[model samples]
Target: MHIHENRPGVLTALNQIFAEQGVNIAAQYLQTSARMGYVVIDIEADGDVAEKALLAMKAIPGTIRARLLY
Candidate 1:
């Protein structure tokens, strides 16, 4: 996901949604440029939960993009 600058609680909100959906985050990485924040998360979930989590992440206010790579 790519987030807008100075957006507090974005990561927390994403994590909350994942937890609410019962998705387990196995690993994560975060990077930021002058104007954008990037996050890559590896998660584990049964059936459609991963897709659900991606949908939830996409719904976040500052998310620029959220998609499954594999």
Candidate 2:
């Protein structure tokens, strides 16, 4: 995930998103400014399902960007 730039409330938005999908975040790091930043979430999810979830995250307006790190 990355900052939406125009949108605010990154953490709250993600927390709600995760709750909605029953995503379990093992670890996470987030830093954002007025423009952009990065979010890394270590999650417990099956491979294929996780990829699909990642795509869904990208589809969210405030997310702007989402990726599953190695």
Candidate 3:
């Protein structure tokens, strides 16, 4: 997944959401520049639940977009 946000609390919020959805983040990668931050998260979840979780992630404040990579 890709998360576009540069502010604090974005990752924490995402973690909370994932926890609520019963998804476990297996791995993650973060890259930040002066203007933005991008996070790629590898999660373990059921297919249906993963879709819902991605949509929830997209709805988070400061998140420009969210999508599954595979």
Name the candidate that leads on TM-score.
3
- Give the lDDT ranking, best first: 3, 1, 2
Please give the CA lDDT of all the candidate structures: 0.77, 0.69, 0.82
Report the lDDT of model 2 for residue 47: 86
Tell me how far the alpha carbon of residue 38 in candidate 2 is from the true structure, in angstroms, after superposition: 1.7
Evaluate model 2: give its TM-score: 0.70
Model 1, runs deviating above 4 Å: 1-6
List model 3 lDDT by residue over 1-70, tens digit each: 6557688888888888889987888998998876678888888887898888888888888888788878
lDDT of 1 by residue, 12-38 (tens): 987898888777889888987766787
Model 3 C-alpha lDDT versus the unseen true structure = 0.82
Query: Clashing residue pairs, candidate 2?
Result: none
Superior by TM-score: candidate 2 or candidate 3: 3
Q: What TM-score would candidate 3 get against the native?
A: 0.88
Error of 3 at 30 (Å): 0.9
Residues 1-70 of candidate 2: C-alpha lDDT, one tens digit per residue: 5445545666666666667778888888877676766777778878876777776677666656677776
Better of 1 and 3 by TM-score: 3
